[model samples]
Target: MAFDPDAKLSDVLAGGYDLNNRLQALLISRPLDSRGQEAAMAFSQELSRVFMLSLSMLNSNAVAPEVRSGNSSGVSAPAKDKRARSDNGEVVTPSKKSREEGVTRKEITPSPHKDGYQWRKYGQKKIQNCSFSRYYFKCNRHRRCEAKKKVQQQDGGRGRLPPMFKVTYVNEHTCHELRAHDDAAARMASPWTASRHHALDGVVDTARGGGGLFDLLPHIVGGGSAEENEAMVSCLAAVVSGSVPSPPPRSSGWPAAPEASASDPAASFVPPAAAGRSASVADDGAMMMVDDTGVSWDPWWSFCPVEEAAGHQLVTNQNHHRDMHMDDAGGFADAVWPEHACGAWRRA
Candidate 1:
C-alpha cells in the first residue's frame, strides 16, 4: 500500500512498514467468494475509466482528439491504427521510424530531471524478444550520486506503447534527493491536503480502527479475528471512498506531469486508450492481475497531479467505454456515478 496524501506523517512513520505487508497480502489473497471478483472488477473499471478519460483530456490539450482536427489543420494523422491515448485523453501519433521488427531491447528514459543531476549516455543493448533498442545513461556528477536512465523507442505492433523511459537511481543520491524534492513539493501543493492529513491522524487516534494492519497483528502479537479483517477492509474501502466526495475540478499548472504536449517527439509512446470498445474481460482480468501482482497502492494517496488531471480527462472516456461495453454482463466497463445514475453509492 502507498501512503495517502491525507495521512499524517507520524502515523505513516509509525505503521508504514505494516501497511506494505498488508497490501501484498491483499493483492494475492483471493476473496472467499465472488465479492473479491466483483470488487476487483469494479475497482479495475474505475481505474481504467479514469486512466482512459485522463489520457483523452491530456491528448486533446496537446494533440488532436480525432482525425478531423488533423484534417482541419491541414496535417494528416498517422496512417496506422497503432495510436495510443494520453492521460489527458488525446490521440498519440506514433512514429513509423521509431521501431523495428523482432527486437527485444526496451529503454526507460528518465523524465527531464526534476532535481539537478546531469547525465551522460554510456551504452546501448538489445534484449531478447523485444522490438526496441535500450540506451543507458549514468550520472556524470562527481558528487557520488549514481543515477541511471534507460531510453527505448516504442514497439509498433502492440498498438499501445509502454512507458518509453525508465530511470533507475543507483545506491547514492539518486532517488533520495528526488523523493525529498517530491516531499517538499507535495507539502507545498495545497494546505487542504495537509489539514486533511492532520484530521485523519486525529481520527486514527479516536477510532482505533485497523485498516490493513489489523490482519498482521495476530501473527506478530495475536490480536484480532476474521471479523476484524472484514471490518477493516470494509472500513478502508469506506474511508478511501469517502476521501474524494467528488472528483477533483480542473486545475492549471499542467495537472498531469512531464510537460505533456502533442508536439513532443516522445509523446507517441505513452500508453493511452483507443477509440474502440474497452478492452475485453480477458484483457481487463489480466490488467487486474497485473495490478494486484504489482501491489503498488501509492497512487491511492500521493496527491498525484497526473492522476487528478487524468480524472478530469476520464469523465469523457468513461462515458464512451461504458456506452460501448453496456451490453456485456456485470456492466463493469462503464463509469457511472452510482449516486447519480445507479443509486448504488450512497454518500458518506
Candidate 2:
C-alpha cells in the first residue's frame, strides 16, 4: 500500500480530537475525585484542541499568503477579522509568538506565593471599587521571556472566609532550570495535600460529639477502661485539691526504689513524688511533674510507686489546708494557688 502524507496527517488530527473529547468526558465525570487531575486534563484537552485547529488552519488553502509567509504588514489586511487594531486606527499585528503560546489564567486560593515560578515585582496599582491593591509581576527567569502576571487579593469583608488571589498569566514559561523545583514546591504547598492529617488508630474521632480533650485522653494514657478512667480522674481531683492519700506500705523485700518500666500497666497508678519529683495533676487528668527550674515533664509514662513513709512526708510538705473553689471569672489565682503555679493543671 502506498502511504499518503495528507491522509496520514488528517487521520492523526482526527484521532487527536477524539482523544481530547474523551479526556474532557473523563474530567467531567471526575473519576479520580481530584481537582488537580481535572485541571490537568482540562489544560491538556485545550492544548490538543488548539494544536488540531492550528493544523487545520495551516492545511486550508484559504489562509492568506501574508500569514503563511510570516509578513507582519500583510497580516494586518482586512481579510483577517481576528487582527487587533491600535488606538491610531492602524491595524496591529499581534505577537505571533505569543499567539502560538497560549495564555492561561488561574485563580489561586489562600495565597499566590505557591505558584512555583520566580516573579519579580514590577509595579502595583489601585483598582476602582476594590479595597486591595493589584500587584504586577514579571517572570525573571529569562530577559527575553515575556511572561507576566497580575496578582490581586480578593476582599473578604469579615475574614470569615479564606482570601483568594486572581493570577492572570500573560505568556508561557520558557525557563527549564527551576521548572521541576517549582512543580515540586507547588505540590508540597497545595492546600489539599497540606491539609491531610495523619491517621492514628483510636486517636482522632470525626464523629459528632467526639471533640475535646476527653476523646484524646484515652489514647494518650495508653488505653484504659471506663472504670480506670473514672478512678484516674478521681485521683487527679484529689491531687489538685491538695488532698492526695498516702499509698500502702510495700514489703521490705521490695527494692527501695522499684524500677518499673514505662510499659508496665501498674506504673500508671504511681505518683510522681515517689520518683523524687514534685507532682501535679492537670484538669483533664494528665499528670505532670516540675523540675527545679519549673520545666514540666509529661506524666503519662512516668508513674512509679513511692514508699508509704516517703509519700506521706512529701504530701505533708506540699499540701496546704485551704478551701478550693472555682471562681465565676475563671481565674485560679485566688482558688487555693497562684495562677502561674498551676502550670501542670492547665490545658496544653
Candidate 3:
C-alpha cells in the first residue's frame, strides 16, 4: 500500500512523529554496542529533521512575508534588495548575512531535546505576554563552529501535550565533533566489541570459555561486599607472591608458580638459620626472636615480590617439631609465618 502524495497528509506526519519517538526510546533503552547507538542516534536525529521539515512546509505560517503582503495589497513587491529573492517569481530564499545559513523552525517533542549534539544554554526569558519562556543555545563544541538555536514550548500543539517545543536554528553545525565524540564513546566500549577482546581478559580467554562482560557484572554492578573485594585483592596478591596457586594457567606470559603442598608443612619450609651471629640485632636495625622451636619463618614471604622464588609456596607451618632446612646458600630459607610465630619481630 502507498500513501496518496496529493491527499491531506496530517495523519501521515503524525504517525511519522509517533514512530520517531519510539525509535529514539528503543535506541536509548537497549544495551547495544556503542557504535550501533551512535548510528541510531544519528538516524533518529535525521528522521526527526525530515518530519519537522515536512510539518513546517504544511503549515500556513511558513508562507513568505512578501507574498502575504503582496496578496493583502493586490500588488507584488519588487525582489530588488529583500533577502532571498529568487530568479523566478514563485519562491524566495532568505539569507540574513553571507555567513548565516538562513533559519529553520520545527516542532519537536519529549522535552529537553536529545538531538545528538551538545549545546551551551546561554539565556532564557519569558516573552512579554506569553506564559512560556524561550531558551537560547549555542553549540560551541568546536572553536570555529558558531551554530545557535532558540527554543520555546509550543502552546497547545496538535500532537503530544505539554512538553513539545518549537526549535529554531539560525545556522547549521560546522563542528565535526559529533563524529569525534562517537568514536571516543566507541573506543571506551571496545571491550564488548568482540569475543577476540571481550571485557573479561581485555582479550578473550577461550581456554576457560569466553568470559566476556558477564564475568565482570558482579564486580561492576557492586553486588559483592567490601570483604569480597578485599578477599579478591588478597587472592591476587597471594598468587603473585606464590603464597597461593595462581588462577588457571593463562596465555599471559608470566608462568604460574608451582603449587606447593601445604599438608606437608615440614618438608615445605625448613629454616636452620645462617651461620652468622646468633639471634642478635641485625645491622639493618631489625630485631629477631628465636622461638624454642627450630623452624623459623619470615613474615614477608606471603607478599614478597621474588620472581625467582615463585617456585616457593606459602608454608603456614604450625609444627614446632620440624627441623630447619637451608637453600643452596648456607643461609636459612625465608618462609612465611607458622600458626604460632606471631610475635617473631619487633619494628626497628
Global CA lDDT computed for model 3: 0.39
Model 3: lDDT of residue 192: 59
Global lDDT of each model?
0.34, 0.41, 0.39
The estimated TM-scores of all candidates read: 0.21, 0.24, 0.25
A best-first ranking of the candidates according to their lDDT comes to 2, 3, 1
What lDDT does model 1 reach? 0.34
- Model 2 lDDT tens row, 1-348: 122345544344445544554554554454666775866567576666656554665456353232233221212223446564432468877687657754343443333433433455567677776755676766654445567776665554112222445555666665443433544565688846533321210122221125554445455543333323334555677889978644322223221122222211122234344433465554443445664446565533221111222233234333321231111111111111111111111222
- How accurate locally is residue 176 in candidate 2, as Cα lDDT from 0 to 100? 41
| Candidate 2 positional error at 43, Å | 40
Model 3: per-residue Cα lDDT over 178-283, one tens digit each: 4345445676777455333223222222212235433453344222222223335555678778795323331242111111111111111222121111233323
Model 2 residue 163 CA deviation (Å) reads 1.2
Q: Which scores better on lDDT, 1 or 3?
A: 3
Stretches off by above 4 angstroms in model 3 are: 1-101, 157-160, 177-348
Q: Which candidate order results from sorting by TM-score in descending order?
A: 3, 2, 1
For every model shown, the clashing-pair count is 30, 0, 3
lDDT of 1 at 171: 29
**Residue 312 CA error for candidate 2 (Å)?**
49
